[model samples]
Target: MNQYIDIVLRSVTIYFFILIALRIFGKKELSQLNTADVILILLISNSVQNAMVGANTSLISGIIAAFALFCINYIFKKVMLKSSFIKKLVQDKPEILIHNGITYYKTLARLGITSDELEEAIREHGLEHYNEVKLAMFEIDGNISIISGNEYLKQTHFKKKIIHKNLAGKK
Candidate 1:
């Protein structure tokens, strides 16, 4: 009976430590997740095994940890809502990766993104060359949003406008 109790205590402590450490590490936004972030998660999980459980986490403790995590996350979001500083800290702000068809090399360097990576990201939007893009930004969620050249917009907008105009006439 005493051994079982000691085991339960150890399991709960490990669960608490892993949960709190992850929350406090402050990689709140997906955009902040880089190679380093992934590696950190892998290492954390590896190190926390003995602390969390022996074979698998027991049902009751898992439920308790889930509830604790959810409550802590709820509190964090509420706090962020009330505090602009916290919001900025948690959410990655949109930053321009390109302006006027020119890549912002310095900004890319600061963000640890290379021009090659930018080109690759833009490729998803069918951009064949850098000059084809008018503006590009790395979104808060780590998505690459690219605005194509003016001619591209003009052609695309014309089609959309024509479709809308035709729909209006039908109405």
Candidate 2:
């Protein structure tokens, strides 16, 4: 019974410690999950699990893992700030899946994104044809960025026109 109580208290305490550690990790830590962040999270969770379970995992191990994670993040951020090459290596370059209505098959294959997936992505943006798309960028985070070729040519909305007219009148 006492052992069960100890386990419960330990779990609760570790849970709060994780929350605090995550907060210290920084805003970008959760909002903008990069490759390194994802890897760290995977490792941290595994380490914490071991910490939660006794025998193989110890309380000290959990605290050490948390501390190590925090240190690594701090060091990496410092390195990234000073080095552009390190930044590029850790933060992957965006891929160009489609350019000027023509699809980059090799790029898509390399990204493992199928034609159907590409079509679905573009279609979700309310785009009907590839010709309407001027530049379709594949972000490092696996997000599709679609820009219409006619964006500049497209007529301004009435709301924008009215605002412009009102500003002109004031001027």
Candidate 3:
């Protein structure tokens, strides 16, 4: 096989692998990452570099690999937009955490959210309590979106929740 072709194939494979890994691992918080998350990303990229480009440490090889990633990412996004099944398979649906000021304890527990975090998000939206919220949704992109029932704060508030791992008693 030609070296450039080999590089493209390898890079594409790595891209899909990483995508599936992230989906399976439930890494929803792309906007807010902790220190360990950042370190893991750096390490994963460094580790995958050799897998994608192999021993060809040349400038052209690196560019080819990058180009392959960009092309695949573009095509993937297009397909996802057009195919609901693919979109659902690749991403999680938005979770409703509260409705009519009623908190869904089960939903919060399932999404690894704590009451304190939810309260903080509510406060950010100028609400004193969850009862003040008309609707609270854990958005697909890892944002806590709050719609307050308060007549003064009718606008929706979107806040990124810091991803927490192994919060005591949450398995």
Candidate 4:
């Protein structure tokens, strides 16, 4: 096989391997990257680079590997759009966490969500308790979306905020 073809084949193989690994691990890993998550991502990229290009570390080999990855990704997305089973395999279905103030404890446990995490998501949406929630869903993107029953409170999308407190007292 040509060296360029070899590079392309290796890159595509690694791409599918990572995709399958992500599917088995769950979609929650896709959201909310912490310091550790960032580190893991950097390490994963570095680890896979050699595997994709093998001993050929030339510029052309690198470009070929990248092109192969992008083409495979585009093809995968198109196939998923036309095939429900492929789409379901790659993405998790949204789950209902709460409805009419009734919390789904079983669903929470199955999704590995703790009570504290649920309460934090509720409080982030300005709700005092689970009883105030009309509906709460564990979205496919790994976010807990809350809909409150209060008429006065305007409906709004919840976005997670990361606060970096300044150590210096000076404002």
Highest TM-score among the candidates is held by which one?
4
> What ranges in model 2 sit over 4 Å off?
1-56, 152-171
Error of 2 at 67 (Å): 2.3
Give the TM-score ranking, best first: 4, 3, 1, 2
Winning candidate number (lDDT):
4
TM-score of 3: 0.86
Predicted candidate 4 versus true structure: per-residue lDDT over 1-171, tens digit per residue = 999999999999999999998888776777756798789889998999999999999999999999999999999999999999999878999999999999999999998888998998898888989999999999998888898999888746556775556745545
Model 3 regions lying over 4 Å from their true place: 154-171
Q: 3 or 4: which has the higher lDDT?
A: 4
Q: Select the stronger candidate by TM-score from 3 and 4.
A: 4
Ranking of predictions according to lDDT:
4, 3, 1, 2
Q: What is the per-residue lDDT of model 3 for residues 8-62, given as tens digits with 9 covering 90 to 100?
A: 9999999999999988777454655889899999999999999999999999999
TM-scores for candidates 1 onward, in order: 0.61, 0.55, 0.86, 0.87
Task: Evaluate all candidate structures by whole-model CA lDDT and list the values in order.
Answer: 0.66, 0.66, 0.88, 0.90
Which is better, 1 or 3, measured by TM-score?
3
Native-referenced Cα lDDT, model 3:
0.88
Error of 3 at 153 (Å): 0.8
Candidate 4 residue runs with Cα over 4 Å from true position: 155-171
Backbone collisions counted per model: 0, 0, 0, 0
